[model samples]
Target chain A: MKARVTVTLKTGILDPQGKAIEGALKSLGVAGIASVRQGKVFDIELAGADPAQAEAALKDAADKLLANTVIENYNIEVRS
Target chain B: MKARVTVTLKTGILDPQGKAIEGALKSLGVAGIASVRQGKVFDIELAGADPAQAEAALKDAADKLLANTVIENYNIEVRS
Candidate 1:
């Protein structure tokens, strides 16, 4: 199974990277960009085939290592 | 309007960060782990409400600044 974990900044968190990207976009002549927030995505391929187990393990990984819970939130999607 | 851009390393690209994360997960006792790949996600807000325009602008942004076309691929999703 494969699990995709998307880790994103919480609302109201300061994202300097996002700000920089927004500025870069504007300078590159890509118009109408209002705001930008950056995040991380983890694509994990597990040895196991069970969807439920993969989801649980991915959630554990997210909580333990993939995300900073105080400032970031993560969503997990499993594919078999 | 909102646009999401997910930037991922192309196949056969070396990802040290993903390896490090996989090691970390193993050390943290998450079982059945195999391989991991990391990517970037950008959540963009557009000033315009038009979905078509937002998608186009986001694609432009991704090509110009958000992604390295040689070693990365990006997918853009627009929401109004």
Candidate 2:
């Protein structure tokens, strides 16, 4: 099974890196870009793991280590 | 218009951050895992932009700034 985890900043949180990217894009003349926000993607390969069990484990992993719960939200997707 | 750019390291490139995460997961008792890879995701909002044009611009941005063409590959998705 393969799973993916995406972690993103909460709506109200400030993202300096994203701001920097947006500014860079504008400077580079990539026109019409209004905003840019950055986040993380984690691709995981699991061996001999059931989809449901992997999803549950990944959720736990996200909650415990992959995300800063106070400032970030994480989404997990499992594919067989 | 909204777009997403996902940048990932090339297959042969070394990813210390991902290795560290894998170690941490193992230490934290995350079982049944094979490997872990990490990447970046950017959420972009374009104002009054046509879908095809936005996608092209995004691809340009990814090539010039969002991704290091030598070591990373990026996928751009533009949604209406």
Candidate 3:
């Protein structure tokens, strides 16, 4: 099974990297870009066959190590 | 309009960050995790209503700034 974890900054958090990206895009002559929010993605391969178990384990992983729950939110997707 | 860009390391690339994440997950007692790959995601808001134009601009941004074309692949999704 494969689990994808997306960890994104919560609304109202300041993202310096995103701001830098927005500026870079503008300097690159890309127009109409208003804002950018940067995040992290983790693609994990598991040795399990049970989708439910994999999802649960990934969620645990996200909560424990993959995300800063105070400032970020994480979503998990499982594929088998 | 909104565009989401995902930047991932190419296959066979050494990802020290991903390796560290894998070790962290194991230390956190999360089982069944075989391997981990880390990537970046950017959620971009654009000032245009045209999906086609937004997609093109985002692709350009990805190629120029969001991704390293030599070692990373990027995927863009546009929403309106």
Candidate 4:
């Protein structure tokens, strides 16, 4: 099975890196760019796992390292 | 509008950080976790912006700072 984990920052958190990226975009002549927020995606391959088991494993991954849990949230999707 | 940018390593990239994270998870007694891939996420609120504009802006941000482009890929989602 294959799983993808997406982790993102919650709203109201100040993202200086994102702001810097936004400024760089504007300076590069990329118009209409108001702002930028950056996040993470993780794709993992799990050998010999059932869908339900893989999802549970992915959630465990989220809790452990995929998300900060302090200022971020995570979601998982499993594919055969 | 609000936009979220997700950046991840392309397959075939050796992610040492992800491997370390996976090891940490295993040590912490989080069972069933076979592997882990670490990535980055960003979220931004664009006041008074259209979805299309926000997406284009996000692509520009990706090109500038959100992604390495050499070994990473990025995806964007916009919400009103």
TM-score of the first chain alone, every candidate: 0.96, 0.95, 0.96, 0.93
Model 4: how far is B77 from its true place, Å?
A: 4.8
Candidate 3 chain A lDDT trough over 10 residues, lowest sum: A57-66
TM-score of each: 0.97, 0.96, 0.97, 0.77
- Can you list the residue pairs that collide in candidate 3? none
* Model 4 misplacement above 4 A: B1-4, B44-57, B76-80
Q: For residues A1-80, could you state the per-residue lDDT of candidate 1 as single tens digits? A: 78889999999999999999888888898999999999999999999988888888988899889999999999998888
RMSD of 2: 1.0
**Interface RMSD value for candidate 1, one decimal?**
0.7
Ranking by TM-score: 3, 1, 2, 4
Give the TM-score comparing model 2 with the true structure, all chains together. Answer: 0.96
Better candidate number, 3 or 4, judged by TM-score = 3
**Model 4 per-residue lDDT at A7:** 76
Candidate 3 lDDT at B66 equals 93
B5-69: candidate 2 lDDT, tens digit per residue: 99999999999999999999999998876788999999999886688888888988998899999
Residue B44 shift from truth in candidate 2, angstroms: 0.4
Counting clashing residue pairs in each candidate, in order, gives 0, 0, 0, 10
Better of 1 and 4 by TM-score: 1
Model 1, range B1-80, lDDT digits (tens) per residue? 88789999999999999999989999999999899999999999999988888888888898899999999999998876
Docking class of 2: high
lDDT of 3 by residue, B9-44 (tens): 999999999999999988889999999999999999
Clashing pairs in 1: none
DockQ of 3: 0.93
Which scores better on lDDT, 1 or 3? 3
